[model samples]
Target: MELQLGVLGVGHLSTAILQGVFEHGVLDPGSVLLADRDPDRLEDFAGLGCPVVPSTELVRAPRILCAVRPQDFPAAAAELAPLGSEHLVISVMAGLGSDSIRSSLGGACRVVRTMPNAGAVLGCSMTAVARGPGATDDDDAFVERLFGAIGLTVEIDERMLSAATAVSGSGPGWVYLLASAMHDAAVAVGFDSQLADTKVRQTILAAARTLETSGQPFDQLIEGIASKGGTTEAGLRVMRENGFVEAVVAGITAARDRGDALGAADQ
Candidate 1:
């Protein structure tokens, strides 16, 4: 919701981010500034009504958002080093660390490290943010407002970011995977492709709503639909026999560990 928004990379994620900010009414097109070395990106931004400048100039804005690749972070930080103490930085890069940024930008400048999934483009994202070690409550609050504009905002420890990245940061893909599977299953069960697609979407939505509002235990909720000799129970037994629950647990754990590995790989 900050008017003085400066973005470092005008790539795919940056475009989605700017679009989300506008669609969510968090920012106006005229108020957002962007910078990137890529001419194609600048041209695209121009069409979107965003002011695209050189990367160095973007850093001069009061609040800068870094969306560049991890390898480009150091260079971007160097460009932002000239900014005054009043500047605040928000980074959504996967592998970059807040400490590296705070050390790069001088004085008591504010730093925010945030991880939001690609779903932010649709204003339905779960964003995790961690402020600088020295950032006051006000600093963190402002960041909460910013990220909340895109979706949900949860303030958590930077160390926990690896796990957060696995869950919220990569949650959209997991959801899509299930959606795809459900659609395919519907089609295999004699439903037309279009019907399967439509029904699967509604099914997913209804199931999510039940999970959201139902006070009953998850096991009880599932059991409510599945009779003692029903098809659902048969499927459930197959899943259990195949270690479905364990596989899911292992998958998320692997994702969390992969995130930690990516962040630390640079060091």
Candidate 2:
């Protein structure tokens, strides 16, 4: 059977996306085709019952998900060039823009660029999508629904994709760093490693759930926890004095600048 969805790469992010699609029943497993240079990666997907095909066969699918790293995209695009305007191309590669994909794959295809975090593996990612000139509202909706199966989806201007890449694409690593710090702090206070890990993980999960469900602003949430002269206030004050916020801002700015440089290279 001709595939409906084609995945060009089978790396971590692509695997997460494919897992979500399978878990959500978004597409029949038999109708999805996967391609990767790594034999182990191909075997992994083959075990899940997805056909491991060549890039030539995969790109024949009506909708293609380009999940290769930015450096690997040119070769994938060359393989996909025979596809025409009917194909809807969605790329999850950071630093690769839609114009470059269109140019590399022949200008006839519709392209949508997206950034999905590692949370996609757990169906909780915050995915940001942007459309190219050839895309239509239907194309936008299709991309949104495709990513939404794996997590929350938002539409943003293509110009802001680099900013989104910094925040959403790179944001998970930042959160993990903070989690590591919290775990270390807990251990310093005499908790065992297992206990500290459990507590820190639960705390972060609870905070994220509260933020999602509560209608309160982030500052209000923080204020609620940090009573005047309380322990939370003391800790927060120490963080502020140590330029924690400034450091975070600087990190995000660096990621965004790097993304800009990559985009420039593509252009």
Candidate 3:
């Protein structure tokens, strides 16, 4: 609560984070300043009693959270260029590296980059934090604390952040895709749409809980459910024959590669 935070954008990810922090009592609404190009987006925070400030005045807070889209960073950077050495800037913009952010923000502001998924809305995000040049231990701990309010936090080398972006940041979408496929398949096979949706949702939740508590490798878990010549085996065999696992690996790799490409382009 002692930290006076300034948030420069209120897009989906930022909105989730702010909602989590406020819901969990991690920070008081009154201590945070919010800003966004779209006034409608700021209305939620404003309703929560968080002060809305102009982007140019974000530097007034010692710790600034930059959640702007990567394409919009240049203009946001111009407004934040006045940040001094004492300021710490936490960025959630995908594919924008710390070096690029620091240079654009007057070359003195401390930068910490993080990737948190939309799960933060319910305080279950798996956030990855990477400390940047000139960021102190205190700064790193502060970043961890802020993200910990939403869920678990992992500190990783900045070089691996792109991989983290693919695995955790975009991981939810992949799961949803699989769930949707299963739901539609159930409906196609004669279950009512509502029943298929409910069953699929429960199945996913149960499987996730089992995976967390099983203490076994994924292959072993899969093998347990798939007996020889059984129904599970039949479905799994078709998936294997159709390159399901390979497709998943390739998809994640492509996402990581795209993130790298975006960062390179920014540089």
Candidate 4:
């Protein structure tokens, strides 16, 4: 909680991240070093008991977190080169890897490449991480802690970052896709829109909470709600017969491939 942290952007993820850091006891607000090009927005860091500096000044902190957009990567990473080998570069930019970041920072800063979804704002995100070859176990552990400050953390080979992107990173989009379909289907079935919205929302949330808290087997729990010869069972039968899971899996595969294409382009 006492370690130095420099947050290098003032965007949504950065702001939500800053808030999560405060709410989840990741670091004392006073210990955070913040920077952004927009001085007006950077002032938000003030109430958190932080020091707001010009972007270049943030390079002084040993644990530098780059939450800027992919387009800003080069300039931002360049500014931190002076910090050199001492700083661990943890980045949240998609389509850019640790090697590119380390390369931009003069090849000595240890890099941690991570992908976190928008749910990070809600403290329920799943973060995927991979380390630069030079990174030590302690560096990886620190990267884990940094993301754990918000939600779940999983480490994998850097090669799988695209798979991680296709899943958790772009997962919220997939979840939203299903939710939207469900919502529209409910309204199509002669239900009031508001009623349909509330039912879908509560049902999804209830089922998720049950999954998290219940010690029962998922099939048993699901079967309990979907009895023999009931509406839910009939719907489940239709979904299974129509290959609902197969379609979802296909979408994820496509997403993963696209991410791979993007990475390959950078080479």
Candidate 5:
């Protein structure tokens, strides 16, 4: 069968995307083509029956997913510059814009820029997508449906993509850091390592489920758990005193700024 989808890189995020697509029946494995510089990585995907092709051949597919690293984009774009206007190019590369991609690829192909978190590995990613100038409504829907198989997707203005990158693309690391802290605290309190890990994981999961289902304001959810003079409230008071909220805001801002810097370099 002819390849319908082409992936430009075979890194962790690319593997997650392929896994989600295959596991969820989004596309047939045989119809997917993969290209990467590393033969080992290509072999890994080849073992799963995906055809390994040269990067130069990626343009043959009607839909192409660019998962290459920011530093590697110039080379990949050179390979894809020959793609015709019929190609729909979707890029998951952080800090790179659709405009940059379009310019690099001869300004002809339809392009979409997306930020999908590590949750894609578990089919729970929070993805934000923005279309380039050449993209049409059909292109938008096609990209959205392709990503929707892996997780929730939101459409946003390209201008806000950096902020989305900070919040959604970089957000998983923040959550994981909090989980690690909670687990460490549990262990310090004399809990066994296994119990600490399980408790912290379940606590985070339950809290996330509640937030998802409650439809309440975040403050309201917090108030529900941290009543005045309660243990939760006491802990929150310490966190507030220690500027936890400020720290989190600063971290997000830094990530956004870094994204802008990366985009600037590409421009």
Candidate 6:
């Protein structure tokens, strides 16, 4: 069978996307081609029946998923300079815009940029997709289907991608930081380390599920748990006093700024 998807760069995020789609039966190995600078990575995927082709051969597939690092795109782009409007370039690289991607690939291909969070490993990522110049509605739908295999996807303007990067893309890292602190706090309060870990993890899982399924707003949900002058309120008061919300907003803004800088550097 002819190859349907050509995957460039088999790094952690790309690997997770591939695994999610493969395991969910959204795509099969026979129709997917893999390429990476790392021989070991290519060899690993090759064992799963995906042919490891050079970047130059990626043109054989109409749809190419480019997951190379932001710093590595120039070289990868050079190798795919032969691509034209017939190709659909789906890029998941952080900080790189669709315009930049198209220009780097000789400005003759359709591009779709996406930001998928680390939860992709668990097939629960929140992915943001932005259509680039020359991409059609069909292209966007195709992209949504691909990323949707790994997680929920939202379509936003290309200009808002930097903000999306800070939120959905880096949001998991922020949650991880909060989870670590909660685990530490539990340990400090006399819980054993193993038990603390278990408690923190399960709490996060349940809380996330509730946040997704509950129709109530965040404040309402918090109010449901934290009665007036209760233990939960007491703890929340301390967090508020410590400027937790402000700190999180500031951190996300800083991350967005960094993403902008990375995009500027590429341009």
Deviation in Å, model 1, residue 210 alpha carbon: 4.4
> What tens-digit string does per-residue lDDT give for candidate 2 at 1-267?
657788898889888887787778877778888888887987866877788888888766888999988888888888878668898898888887788788888888888999888889888999999988688898888787778888999899988888998998889899999999999999999999999999999999999899889999989999999999999999999999999999999999999898899889888
Q: Clashing residue pairs in candidate 5, if any? A: none
**Any residue pairs clashing in model 2, and if so which?**
none
| Residue pair clashes in candidate 4 | none
Candidate 3 has an lDDT of 0.90
Which 10 consecutive positions of candidate 5 have the poorest summed lDDT? Answer: 39-48
Which runs of model 1 end up more than 4 angstroms from their true locations? 1-3, 39-50, 106-108, 179-202, 209-217
Off by over 4 Å in 2: 1-3, 39-51, 184-198
Instruction: List lDDT for all candidates, in order.
Output: 0.79, 0.87, 0.90, 0.83, 0.88, 0.89
Considering TM-score, where higher is better, how would the candidates rank from best to worst? 4, 6, 3, 2, 5, 1
Q: Write the per-residue lDDT of candidate 1 for residues 197-254, one digit (tens) a residue.
A: 9998998899988976899999999999999999999999997998978977888899
lDDT tens readout by residue for model 5, 79-197: 87867789989999888888878889888888988889988988899999998878899888878777888899999998888999889888979999999999999999999999999
RMSD of each: 3.4, 2.4, 2.3, 2.0, 2.4, 2.1
lDDT of 3 by residue, 143-254 (tens): 8878988888999999999999999999999999999999999999999999999999999999999976889999999999999989999999899999999999999999
lDDT of 6 by residue, 188-234 (tens): 99999999999999999999999989999999999999999899999
Q: Who wins the TM-score comparison?
A: 4
lDDT score of residue 162 within candidate 1: 86
lDDT of 2: 0.87
Instruction: Please provide TM-scores, in order, for all candidate models, with all chains considered together.
Output: 0.82, 0.89, 0.89, 0.92, 0.88, 0.91
| True lDDT of residue 93, candidate 1 | 82
